[model samples]
Target: MPNSSPPVTTEAAPSEQPVIRWTEAGEERSALWRSERGAPPPKRVVLADDTTTADTAYRQACEGTALLWRGDFHNARQLLQALARRADNVPARKRKKAAQVVPVADAFHQHRLAQSQRARMLGMLLIPFNADYSIPLRRAPDVKTACTEAWGPADAAAGASVASLRELLGITSAHEWRRKGVEIAALGEPPHNRIHPHYGVFSPVRGEYIQLVATAHLPKPPPGQTSLMAFDVGTGTGVLSAVLARRGVRQIVATDQDPRALACARENLAQLGVADQVQVVQADLFPEGQASLVVCNPPWLPARPSSPIERAVYDEGGRMLQGFLKGLTAHLAPKGEGWLILSNLAEHLGLRSRAELLEAFERNGLRVISRIDAKPQHPKASDASDPLADARSREVTSLWRLAAIQ
Candidate 1:
């Protein structure tokens, strides 16, 4: 983190959380006490060990307290799993709350606080592994299988590992996603119609943007140009590039800053038999030169991310969004169009406004030619229990067809 970087705002900001100091095994130990941010600070900090009962751990977590583990790593994971079970089974009396209406922005803020608190509690259970990802504690189940499954075989050379149980769960979930693969109807047919996302790359489970890219009209090639070419900015898994190639675009170039995303895109393009048509390049936002069409799907949230995985969802200060908008004209060919995929959730939450978005277009020498809209079909959209449901239910994703101002 640099001096200019914004302060960490999430519950996982270890620097902002409480600190714990205690004598462990006759040695003094000090560590940051992980607790949910935006909520009341933990009223209790107990040094929990392998001998701590799961019931006690669950009780403490439910009481808005924290447990700093100084025990075997494997037991910590089991304790976390137990805590999750207990958290899921909320008591009826405690579960009931009056449904009071809150302003959209306030509701969104509260929703984030609840989420941060939940993650903080879950993150308390930690895991420690040796250089080879081998557990050092006795009676620990062999995690080599799970580790290898999540991280590739190359991870065997990992020098040392210290991560939260929540993070481990993420890796495990990634392995399942990699195996099952997200189905993209716009990509083509059954068995071969999916993008296998790498561990850190953003998954393309939201199909609305892909559909927009697939069905939207493509700008005609310049009069003298021999064939069609398009650019896919921030291509995560090359799904958008593949969609363009499959739709008969002669050539496509996809750019991304992350090496993991570049590799994932390359593999997917090759698997889809469009490797020759789509070139994957490593670049911050845009590649060199220009094309007939440009597509960008930036992170929706304009906030600081707590971890690497969250980077795909959070666009700090709307850097990517504003960057793509401002740079679209320079890289687009004559009469070219830029397809911007964005969600209105930010507007609903009062983080950004429609007037601001439109002003960005005007200031960037771009004007909306047309817009195609779609509602999200993900499970979260229909989750009534979600504190942000009001905004989610009304949120609409749009593919804004933009052209350089005359």
Candidate 2:
């Protein structure tokens, strides 16, 4: 059966906090909630433990029942793994029809469905929480430090809570990611100097985009001006903005719609000592004015995201790309140029084409003046075993210098 509850997207503020009410030993007890992006509360929840067989747990989960685990920590983890294996055992109906070759797009869609199903099934192992983010299960390790690191110091009355153990693992992982950040060679600093990413903010591990920004020649200065101004659209971790500042752009306006990303960018800029050169703002796209150079690295894919975090990598209908193109002319000072950094992975996947992209520029009254290309060196590019290996292997990153057509 399909998952009864839909996963929550973090960006869309929940109208109300989720609460779980269940009858345990004939006594009703409840807890308020936070999420890790899985289905809404299951209609029914039953307490489970080491005694709960994997068969029973899997059956209950498939039937839309939440299993509030009261087992030993390690056992709970094992139950989750077993449940995942069960979930991946596909039924005959979902198997390929005889003599049928799945289309590339269809295969991709199926892959996403399997991933979603696996997540929902594994998320059935629920952990109870104190108001301060402690797991009350026996043998649970101290996650207070990690929880506080990700969600901030919890409220004394945040209330009784039940959240997925998988989510807790992610919280701890994010805490570690922030502590030992990903290094960006463009940001000249000690090897340890890094871009600490907060949960949900996209990390700039792909240095190709930053490399293009670092080397792309700046547009000629406007008459009577000794300095250049730039815009870093959809700035995540403000890494691109920092790169522009390092390139000696006198002023930059870096913008992002997510509060987490906005704050993340500000913190990164301050760390890079470019806080004074860049103004980080929370805007849907562009900031208040025109600039000599506008740089945008929109998500390359044209698809609906499954969750908020996916938004950084998937631009629905290519809205961000089109918007940047449409607004480029109006926001350009005389002789101004816009730099568009993009990847051709979507083309290889049959999602978008190069002709369509250039036509988008034509529709927006802009023309490409120059293009800088870089090949991706990320591990995924060469991982021949990835589901999307065909597309990844052929991907090419490009930095297109664009200008308003005369």
lDDT score of residue 173 within candidate 2: 83
Residue range 168-261, candidate 1, lDDT tens digits:
6677678678777888999878887988887788899999879999999989998798788899999998999999999999789999998879
- Superposed on all Cα atoms, model 2 deviates from the true structure by an RMSD in Å of 4.3
Error of 1 at 115 (Å): 1.6
State every prediction's TM-score relative to the real structure: 0.81, 0.91
Off by over 4 Å in 1: 1-51, 58-78, 85-100, 136-160
Judge candidate 1 against the unseen true structure and give its global Cα lDDT, from 0 to 1: 0.76
How big is the positional error of residue 296 in model 1, measured in Å on the Cα after superposition?
0.4
lDDT of 2 by residue, 1-406 (tens): 1122222222222547677766666566777656755457766777888788889889878867778877788888888888887886666776555115667667666667768777777777788878777787788988888887656788886677778888877877887888888888887777635888888787888999899999988887789989898889899889899888887887999999988898889988898888999999988788988999999999988887766778878888999999999888998989999999999988887788899998999999998898999999999999986778878998899999999999
Model 2: lDDT of residue 239: 89
Query: Which residue pairs of candidate 2 clash?
Result: none
TM-score: which candidate is best? Answer: 2
Lowest lDDT sum, 10 consecutive residues, model 2, at 1-10
In candidate 2, position 30 carries an lDDT of 70
